[model samples]
Target: MATLAEKFGLRKASGVGEAGWGHTLIVALVSLIYFLPVLMIIFTAFKPSAQALSVPPTLSPTSLFGLIPDQFVFTPTLENFGQVFNRVMVSGSAAEPTGFDVFFFNSFFISSVSVLLALVIGTLASYGFSRYPLKGNDTYLFIILTTRMLPAIVVIIPIILMFRTVGLSGSYLGIIMLYTAFNLAFTIWMMKSFFDELSYDVEDAARIDGSSEIKVFMKICLPQVVAGLAATFVFGLILTWNEFLFALLLTGVDTRTVPVAMNQAVSSGGRGTDWTLLASIETLFLIPVFLVTFFLQNHLLRGVTFGTVKR
Candidate 1:
């Protein structure tokens, strides 16, 4: 009987026995290298402000006698996180709130709504293109893609002017609209590819069973492309959440997103950057994206490779 590894065509490293320990060691090393910066951020987030800026950075918490420089024996504290959320005491009084909670809400709302709008509109458009071909369908797709190809900076001036003329500058709606527009081209192209890869047999069978076109799309076709939708939503959310230029230029203090707030938090009051506080903010900022990716990891993996395999 063929072993599992042999059946899967995964051979052990030559001359290294059947365990592939050498290959496993190499993969572990590469993963560690990739995660080193994230580990540093997390470590710094728990350090005191002074320790975070100490000469020759140390990964371990600082001890009174300072254990060996490389030893992980320092004490951990929540001072930085307290400062990030304005929960720290200042001069024996409760510190004023920093409004970080508002920034987080703004980022979440804008990213979620923009990605959903793009997904809905793009999915319908993609289905139309895939199922109902027209004389210039390819040309239309290329045109839509060209919108994404343009440098965002190149069109910022005109967009700013248009938003101002429409009295939409600095409003949540304005930023959300811009994000949706930016995400639309990517959504359309990606979803269209998935739809194109789907066989027509299932859809045709549904049509023959007295299903309306809309019913066929809603009940049959949409379910088949769920992985693709998940992948597109995650990418679009990341892009909009991290967008700095548009948020900086178009949003007011009341509507500012986390990225813009992070920049201000770093240099606010011109008192120099607080490395520990910055790390704390970065750690918090990573949570939502991490959670979303974690929950959707299986779908994301399938979506990315959906069209590559052929039966």
Candidate 2:
């Protein structure tokens, strides 16, 4: 009788092939290690307080020995979600009007507006740079990059002074403008690379066919760079979403972003350190970014590598 191994063409002495079982085992182990923290987070997100905080944490339901009261039976309640949405609980153990809803909306508004402005400004700058060679181009690029390198704290006073002079301080417009300015450097560099890789012949052909320059750009060039746009949108969204210092320093109560609001939630007295609530809010905040990456990851990879190899 042939054994199970024999049925699968595995012999006693097939050792160290590139496609060997050992390689498969190693790959599986590496994947598990990389995913462990995420799995733990998912578990904690679903757990009740005692389960979430249990010392020598139980990795599975069976570890509880089914001894938990039915009241605590991992019953998923939307109470925390309700709290996050319905009311911004105030300081103390008692719930107050924390205004997280306002913060969430502000974060979305700031991120969206900044990304739109960035793409527009970046597209123009990148197109110009791609079409024309400027003197001291390397120096210009470095100077632009340097703008991003300046410490946020170092520029806060100048920014505050500038905003104060213009009556933009602590306003949504102020923070959105600040984010757009800061994000523009990177956006231009990335989009310029994309534009440089594009075929000039296509645009030339369009010109010969009597298509205007603007038409060529709108109808021909833009289609080829859709992936670049998606990649840039993801970058700008993430930068704006996680930007805490500028949002915190530049905006007042009405314009606080999720990150700043989350931080502020912690200093609201005894309830500030509610790890469970914090975890939940963090988990919620992370979902949109995750979905964006998951959906656009293929396009981003392809766009980023578009011109790297010529076959």
What are the lDDT scores of the predictions, listed in order?
A: 0.85, 0.77
Instruction: Give candidate 1's whole-model lDDT.
Output: 0.85
What C-alpha lDDT, on a 0 to 100 scale, does residue 296 get in candidate 1?
A: 85
Off by over 4 Å in 1: 1-19, 61-73, 87-94, 303-311
Give the distance in Å from residue 155's predicted Cα in candidate 2 to where it truly belongs.
2.7
Q: How do the residues 69-97 of candidate 1 rate in per-residue lDDT, one tens digit apiece?
A: 55444458988887886843346776888
Worst 10 residues of 1 by lDDT: 7-16
Per-residue lDDT tens digits for candidate 2, residues 1-311, read 76543443444454234487888999999999998877666555556666667665646544266665444345444456555555545435555666888988898899989988999998888888788769977777778788778788887878888888998878998998889988889889988888888888878989999999899988888777878988998988998899888887789889889999988775565653665566667777888878987898756654433343355
Q: For candidate 1, what's the RMSD?
A: 4.9
lDDT at 63, model 1: 60
